[model samples]
Target: MFRRHKPSSSEHKRDPAIHAPALPHNDMRSFFSLSQLVLSAGHLKPPPVLRHSKTTYFEVEILDAHSKKQICVVDKIPPSSTLLDVKHKFHKVCPQWSPSRIGLRLERNGSYLRDSVNIKALAASSIITLYFTDMGQQVTWTTVFLTEYTGPLLIYLLFYLRLSSIYDAKESARSLRHPVVHLACFCHCLHYARHLLETLFVHKISEGHTPLKNMIKGCTFYWGFTSWLAYYINHPQYTPPSFGNKQVTISALVFLLCEAGNHFINVALVHQNQSGNKGSFPSPSINPFTWLFLFVSCPNYTYEIGSWMSFTVMTQTLPVGVFALLMAIQMAQWARKKHQLYLKKCTTYRWRKRAMIPFIL
Candidate 1:
């Protein structure tokens, strides 16, 4: 057999398509190596990356307090939101309900949740439940106080002026008004005027509101009692105090002292609250009026009762006495409630301190 002749390297290089088929002239792979193709593809047209972001969202479910049925759901709220923010959201969903008229609680019969509470703190998990109460038509505390104090001032003034419609024409024309009557009018006006001024300028009232019906009832009581008291105190037939000037003088001095003490105590309370020490046990300060705090939990109420009692003694009238008695009863109730709150919240509060009266109450 004849030996096959091997092809030389120069022959293979010179001949085209001798061992393999020829490639297309426009082929890209012809000018690039495998590694170069991969690197260029990566830099020019990279693959897309899939990324997912995680965020925490909260859901608040509102239910009726009485029925325990779902009212609405506030969803997708951020963890940083507060109860006030939730109230706004709820208001948007229920246009008929106002933020002031809506009361929210954790349980059906629980106390209302404060607007300052954070939603994250209230949430046990991603979803939180709240109870809703439809507080009837609301009025601000400022409006209620203004109405209550203003009516007494004006009503007493009307009687004091001896208006033709209110008094007998013959009685008004014949008998001269007593000096005590004038003094009583001055005291009454001063008391209510001070209250009005304090309500407008001094008191640090909360943003809370009261029911309209309650305001109406309060106005009725204050206005009715004022008219009753003024009719007798400013009457032409009215008699002076029983022990004459001596009794009147002593009672007036006591009234003035109590009034001054009450004002100072109120100022101290406002100052303490502004100093960011609210809800803490208030101690005696440089002011002498605050010394009563050592003996009584509510010195303001004590001074208020003292003022009214002195007024009753100065007038020496059954109406004034009745008014003072009723007022004292009410103030005592309020003071007791406040005293209990202080005892519960402040560990340093003295257990021996009374509510309104010291030593005996």
Candidate 2:
């Protein structure tokens, strides 16, 4: 056989599509080089095409919270609609329902949805469902409080005036009126009167209604306590405190100071709330009376407890002391709750801040 002609080295080098010449037989280096070339070309394969599902509008269904009956289906609600906007749209179909009296929830028994939440903010599917509950017979918190406080103020004065036949006439004639007793009556009236004024004007209480049952319970507590305390304080046989005039003077002064401080704190707190600076730690300003906030998270409760303690000292009666003690316990509970709320909302709150008392509690 004729000898095969070999291609020149220049021809192999010049051709772009020329395959490499055959590797030397059983040469491991040449075999490895061929493997590397194959691996380098693998990236040329096209990546799998990615598919996405787009959502434009949402479908919403409303159901009664209690019976789980389907109220209506809302088709094609835009993402920009707020919860309040949805409520208004629901009101159009259901004429019996008012927006203020309607509470909507995400689940059957879940907490009501806030009006501020937007439909787009929720991680909802194409179909969104909301449960509705009827919020019946609403009254403002200020109205409820004013009603409760007003009753006690007038009822206590009835006892103070001795207008009711509750006291014995013969004993009343023999009983000597202590100056401290008159002072206590004046202070009690002043306190409740101030509360009424604050409820009407100074406080920027939120525009929310309290339940009828809660209003009843609050009235019972306040009116009942006023009767109980006023009965003893205004009694004909009531005697001067054991420590006499000196104790009365000092306690009365303390009571006045604490009452003034409490009013100031309430004003400051109302101003703070109105300023829309919630979720921030409260600090003392130019008002020195509010400086108690430096040590206690709830200085209002501190001053409240102080006022009651002073009253207990001035009266020096078992009932007054017991009332003061009970009030302290209740106020401490309120203070602890407020303190916890402050801690949760305010990142910069002082770790050493007490609930009500300074340094001790």
Candidate 3:
């Protein structure tokens, strides 16, 4: 059974912000501080190319209620146009918006109103709201899945990176070598890059573009993505120091168990939210370890630190090992804050409910 990090009752009494719905639990939060701002997966992709695959090229359709003229228009669209283009279109419709403040409305099929919306295929009830009067008078776009529906954009960006690296293959090979060492490095870069883009885009599109103090504001790692990553590091191919098959196999299984538990919990959590039971987005990636954290506090961070430590032992990568150490320091800060919050808020909360570990700390 996974434990959910339960703060004392006294902690809940004092902090209203602590009652937030599930926050996205992306691992990128641990990598770059810049990722907290870019929240979506696709913000970093390049312009779309519309390759002639089975998927059709993007098209826009306009419908109007007799008296209500369609206020939306697309003056000019580059095939490589980006979210910035959609915002620019809004500025033309209503001149008050700055480039920073302007955002376009999605047409419910999860796309910009005028670009590539498969409206006919969408639900009759899906109404894309471009502006929220409750939040503000100025029109702004939704940030749920900008990159999900879009294509060619991701294609362009990925190809660019791969080719860019290819152009420098000779030089890179001299230093990084080939096969597993290189693949591991590649995965590491992708993981960090993915985190940076996802976090930054989320900030820009959904959360008002405000900077986060740091990524792990108050979440636990219930998800064990880090543990799996660690498995490779602990392998002889990566980290010969911890190259026992038992640790590799055991850590791998523990990670899978966390993954399975996460999905099972998600079935209920996702269904509950679908029935209009939540305030914001269901977390980005909730793992099984989350349930574990209720009792353990910060299991995600603890597992991650352990993963990297083992990885360091396996791969003998001093730089990445140091990176993991710094991450632990950050997690320690989060745990300390939670510990104080527990004492202050939860009258019934036991003093022994340590943030990262139980009883020992």
Cα shift from native, residue 227, model 1 (Å) = 0.9
Sort the predicted structures by TM-score, highest score first: 1, 2, 3
Q: Which of 2 and 3 is the better model by lDDT?
A: 2
Best lDDT among the predictions, by candidate number: 1
Cα lDDT of model 3 by residue, 1-361, tens digit:
9999989999998987778665556744654655655674646777888877552222322223223345554443434555455455655766665545442344323333333333334323323324211112322233223322122223323433334432454533344322434434433444344434543542234423311211122111211333334333423333333445555445444444533443343354445455683432223235444455455444545555565564454345665566667777888889778567656655655555567655654
Candidate 3's TM-score reads: 0.35
**Global CA lDDT computed for model 3:** 0.44
Candidate lDDT (C-alpha), each: 0.89, 0.85, 0.44
Better of 1 and 3 by lDDT: 1
Residue 142 displacement (Å), model 3: 11
* lDDT at position 12, candidate 2: 83
> Model 2 over residues 140-225: C-alpha lDDT tens digits?
79889898989988988888877539888787777788897898888888878988998888888877555667888888988888
TM-score of each: 0.82, 0.76, 0.35
Compute the lDDT of residue 243 as modeled in candidate 3: 47
lDDT tens per residue, model 1, 1-361: 9999999999999986798877776564656676677877666656689889888999999999999999999999998999999999999999899988999999888899888899999989999999999998999999999999999999999998888898888898898976678778888888889899998889999888888999999999899989998999888788888799888889888888888888888888888899897779778898888899999988999999999899899988888889899999999999999999999989888889999999867
Q: What residue runs in model 2 are displaced by over 4 Å at the alpha carbon?
A: 1-60, 73-100
